[model samples]
Target: MRVLVTGGAGFIGSNFALRARERRPEWQLTVIDAMTYAANRASLEPVLTTGEVALVEGNIADAALVDGLVADHDVVVHFAAESHNDNSLDSPWPFVESNVVGTFTLLEAIRRHGKRLHHISTDEVYGDLELDDPARFTEQTPVNPSSPYSATKASADLLVRAWIRSFGIEATVSNCSNNYGPRQHVEKFIPRQITGILQGVRPKLYGSGLNVRDWIHVDDHNDAVIAILEQGRLGETYLIGADGERNNLEIVRMLLELMGKPADWFDHVDDRPGHDLRYAIDSTKLRRETDWQPRYGDLHAGLAQTIDWYRTNESWWREAKVAAERTYERLGR
Candidate 1:
């Protein structure tokens, strides 16, 4: 099988690329990444030498480039997008360009190539979960995005759906929650906390630090995506997650315990505008329909190993941040 993955060097994308190589050694994989601050080529450096994996550095919004790649590959997994909420908060234009326009670029590829498409999304599109209510975000949940990031993602999701309904396209969407584990960019909460503890930086938690998120390890998330390709019905969206819910304060406490750091190491900062209180996904449909399962033990065990990863892979992420430094310099941030 040949798969063209946009943004495959990023968090979930890198994991998918690596896992795809393992699952199908003969598969020819092409990864097109824009090499943004959040993208670390070294995260995918191991696969670079594999010969089967080819890396093309470019933006997904480049319709000509995306169309050619989508035409060549049997499956186009559109994982590329402006992923960080904080970054999106600073600049929604890029989010609109990448998540919305870039997604449309891929949809155009499907229109021309007639290849299968799978678009990765976030559970944030369902907006804040009501703690007192019994509702959990399912594939059928109505979108009520609370942030610019989720808003753009929701917009792109709708566009992809429209292409399917109107153009007779083969497209699938996976709306997942917070992902943790190796190769995650430092700006994300999990790796941010892990890297902060390692570097003696006091990680900041917004508000009371009680915002809840369903945690899914990246490896398990990759498995779920692979299963969708192998077994899922096209033109359908799947909610991929471990159904493990955790609060920001709880995650911070775990990181503190694992690193032998103290609660004093945490700095409670003012909350970001439009921050969601919680995110929960009902993944029962995904579980019943696919042979996929979460391999990372439970929330605690997965996080324990994840913390150890940053502890051991400090050089990996330190080198990874050099790219961010350049972006900071370029933007005068």
Candidate 2:
């Protein structure tokens, strides 16, 4: 099988690429990445050196480039997007361009080529639920995006549904919860905190740090995506999660304890605009339909492993950390 993975140099995409190569050595893998600040080419170095995967640097919004790549691949796992909420708040145009227009370009290309597509999305598209709400976000949850990042993702998801129903495109969508694992950009919440502590800097929290998020390991999320690609029914949506839900405060305290610091060893920063209160996902449909399960079900264990990765792989994320911290400092975050 020839597969095209957009944003393959990014965290989750790179994990998916590595796992795909390991599971199916015979399959040819092509990665299209924009080489954004969040993307690390070093993440793909192992597979690249072995010639098991090919990396192409370009924008997925480039219709001509997307068309050619989609035509050649049997399957396209679309992971390209401007995914950071804070960055989206600062600049929404890139989110619109990459998440909305880029998705449209891929949809059109897949429609013309008749190739399979599996779109990777986020649970944030369904917006936040009240902290006291007992209900979790299912596949049936209606999209009510709160941030520009999620709004664009919601727009992309709508476009995919329209293409599937109107044009009969072969595609499936999976909205996953928060993902934390190796190769993640430092600008993201988990990595930023982890790298901050490693650098002897106090971790920063936003607001009251009471906002809840359903976290999943990146590898588990990627595994679910592959299952949906291989077994999911067309025109269907799946919510991918591992039943891991923790508020920001809980996570920060845990990180401090694990890193040998006091629970109160952190600073509270101003919250970003339109910060959602909580997000949780019920992945019952995905689990029931596919013979898939999460391996890193323990949040603390997963976090410890992630911290170890950053500790050992300093060269991979050091430069990105300096730049991301500079931006955060400028924003007083």
Candidate 3:
């Protein structure tokens, strides 16, 4: 089986590629990435050991590039996107181009190539939990995205559905929870917290920092992605998560505890506009139908391991930070 993974150099996609290679030893893997600031080549270096995995540097929005790559692969996992709520707030055009237009481009390629696809989505696309509930987000949940990042993702999901319906393209979508672990760009919450602590900079907290997000380890998310790729039903969407839920303050406190930093060090900042209160997904379908389960089920241990990854790979992060600033300056908000 030959597979093409878009955004394979990013945090979750890299882990998924390595884990998928282990699962399907005979399969050939090709990873196409624009190598955005969030996607570090260092993260994908480990997977380059085998000649089976090829890394192509190109944006998924390029129809010609995507068409040529998808024509031969049996499966395409679409993960390439400009993902970040803060950055999205600063300038949403790039997010739309990557998340919405890029996804449409992939679906169009799949249609032209007659290949199956798995479009990776996020829980944020389902929008904020207007009414709080512990039960997971089912496929039937209505999409009402609040932020630009999520709204674009929701638009992509709609495109996936349209392709499956109109063009008869073989495809599925998986909306996952918050992903945390190694190789996550320092601009994110966990890495940002760690970096700020290390730099003696006070970590900023939006509002009361009570906004909740379902946490899933990168490795665990990789397992779920492979499960869907291998066993997921066509034209159906699935939710993948470890059922790990934690609010902002709780997560910040955990990070501080691991780094021996203090909660008092937090800088109370005004909340970002339209920040979601909570996000969680129900992966009951994933658990029962597929032989997929998360290894990092323990949030504390998972978070500690994540902290350790950042601690040990400080230089890796330093380079990533420098690269991300280039994108930030371009947005010029």
Candidate 4:
């Protein structure tokens, strides 16, 4: 199989590329990434160095480039986007361009070439649930995006559904929960706190730190994506998660304890505007349909493993950390 992986240099996408190479050695892989601030090329060094994957530094919104790449590949796994919520809140134009316009570009290319497409999306598109609510987001959940980042992603998902129905495009979409693991940008919640502590800064929490997020290992999330791509029904949407729900406070405490610090060794900061109270995912359909499950179901163990990665690979995140901290300090976040 010849596969085109968009955003293959970013966190989940890079991990997808690495995992794909290991699982499908016979498949030829090509990556097209915009190489944004969140992307780290070094994450893909293993496959790139071995010639197992080819890299194309370009934007997915480049219609001409996308057309050519989609035509040659058997399928496209789209993971590219401006995905940071804080960044989106600060600047919304880039989110519109990269998430909405970019997905439209890819859909057009796929439609033109009659190629298969697997669109990666986030559960935030379904909005937040009450902290005490038992309901979790499902495939049928109506999009109620509250932020620019999620609104753009919701727009992109709607475009895919429209294409699948109106143009009969072969595509499937998966909305996943929060992902944490190596290669994740330090600006994100888990990494920001983890890297902050490593840099002698007390971890900062927004508001009361009661905001909840359903977490999943990057590997598990990618595995589910692969399953949806290979075996899922066309035009179907799958919710991917591992039941790893934890409030922000719990995660912070766990990180502090894991790093050998007191659980109360963190500071509180102003909350993000319109911060979602909680997000949960009900991935029953995905598991039943694909017979897939998460390998890293233990959040603590998974976090420990992730901490080890950042600890040993300080060089990978060091430069980005300085710039990210500066931005945070200026914003007082």
Candidate 5:
């Protein structure tokens, strides 16, 4: 099988490529990424050297490029997007172009070529559940995206469904919860705190640090994607999660403890505008339908492993960290 992975230079996409190589050695893989500030070519260097995977630097919104790439590959796993909420609030246009326009381009190509596709999306598109609510986001949850980033993602998801129903495209969509592991940009919450502590800087938390997020390891997330690609029904949506629900404050405390710092070593910063209070995902369909299970069931063990990756590969994140911190400073976050 020939597989084309979009945004393969970024965090989750890069890990997906690595895992795909290990799990499906016979498949020919190609990655087309925009190589934006959030993307790192080094993440795919290992597989590139072995000639198991080829990297193509391009934006998914380029119809000419996307049409050609989609025509050649047997399947397209789309992970391209401007995903940071803060950046979306600062500038919404890029998110719309990358998420909505890009998906439309791919949908057209996939429609013309009759190629299979698995659209990757986020649970934030379902908006946030109340902090006190016991309900988790299910497949039936209506999309109520809070930020520009998620709004564009929700738009992309809707586009896919429209094409699937109207044009009869072969595709599936999976909305996953928060993913944490290696290769993540330092600008994100988990890496910001981890790398901050490593640099002798105090970790920064937003608002009261009570906002909740469901965390899953990138490896587990990719594993589930593989299952859905292989076994899932077309025109279906699955929610992917590991049942690892944690609030911002609890996560900061966990990181501090893991890094041998005091629990109170972090500072509270201004909360994001219109920040969602909490997000939780229910993956009952994904589990029952694919027989998929997560390996990093313990959040503490997963975080410890993540911390070690950052410590051992400081070179990979050093330059990016400098720019990311500067942006945060400008925002006073």
Candidate 6:
């Protein structure tokens, strides 16, 4: 089988590509990445050098390119997007161009070729649950996105639904919770803290550091996506998450302890505008419908392994860290 993986150089996509290559050695994997600031080609070096993966550097918004790529592949795993919330706040146009327009381009290509598609999305599209609320975001949750990043994603999700119902496109969508594991950009929460401590820099926390996020290991998220691709019904949406929920304060304190530092070693900064209070997910549908379960359900153990990746692969993330920290410092974040 031939597969096209968009944004395969980015964190989660790269992890998916790596895992897919290992699991299905007979499959031909083609990766098309825009090579944005958050993307590193080095992440896919292993598979690329072995001739198991082909890398294409280009924008997903390029309709001509997307059309040709989609036509040749049997399955398209759409992971391309401008995903960082802070970056979207600074510049929303890229989010719209990459997330909305890009998704439309791919959907059109898939519609034309009658290819299967698996769209990867985020739980942020459901907005946030109040800290005290007992409810979690499910497949049925109404979308009330707060950030430009999520709004575009919500729009893309709607477009996919329309294509499926109106045009009979073969596709499935999975909205996963915040993912933390190897290959994550340093700009993300867990990696920023991990790389910060590694560089002898104090970790920075926003507001009271109590905002909650439902975390999932990247491998678990990829596994769920694979399950959906292989076994999910068409026109269905799945919420993918492990039952790992923790507030920012708890995560930071745990990281400090793991690195042999005091809990209060980090600095607190002003919060981002319109920062959601909390996000959680209900993945019962995904778990029950498919025989998929998360292996790294323990956040601490998962984090330890992630920290080790950043520590040992300094060359992979060092340059990105310098640039990301410079931007953060200028923004006073």
Candidates 2 and 3 compared by lDDT, better number? 2
Which tens-of-lDDT digit does each residue in 120-237 have in candidate 6? 9999999999999999998999999999999999999999999999999999999999999999999999999999999898888999999999999999999888899888988999
Q: Write the per-residue lDDT of candidate 3 for residues 1-333, one digit (tens) a residue.
A: 888999999888888788787887788999999987778888777778656589999999999998999987999988888889988888899999999889988888888878999999999988877436755578889999998999999999999998899989999899999999888888787787777677676776778888998999988888888888778889989998888888889888888887788767686677878988888888899888899999998899998998888778888898666555466446441
TM-score of every candidate relative to the true structure: 0.94, 0.99, 0.93, 0.99, 0.99, 0.99
RMSD, one per candidate, in order? 2.5, 0.7, 2.3, 0.7, 0.6, 0.7
User: Candidates ranked by lDDT, best first?
Assistant: 5, 4, 6, 2, 1, 3
Lowest lDDT block of 10, candidate 5: 324-333
Per-residue lDDT tens digits of candidate 1, residues 77-171? 88999988877877789999999989988898889879999999999998987666667889989999987899999999999999999999988
Error of 5 at 263 (Å): 0.8
Off by over 4 Å in 3: 130-135, 322-333
Clashes in predicted model 2: 0
lDDT: worst 10-residue window of model 6: 19-28
- Candidate 1 structure lDDT: 0.86
Global lDDT of each candidate: 0.86, 0.93, 0.85, 0.94, 0.96, 0.94
Badly placed stretches (over 4 Å) of model 6 are none
In model 2, the Cα lDDT at residue 95 comes to 97
Model 2 error, position 330 (Å): 1.6
| Cα misplacement distance, residue 42 of candidate 2 (Å) | 0.2
Q: How far is candidate 5 from the true structure (C-alpha RMSD, Å)?
A: 0.6
List, residue by residue over 6-94, the lDDT tens digit for candidate 4. 99999999999999988888889999999989999999999899899999999999999999999999999999999988888888999
lDDT of 2 at 13: 95
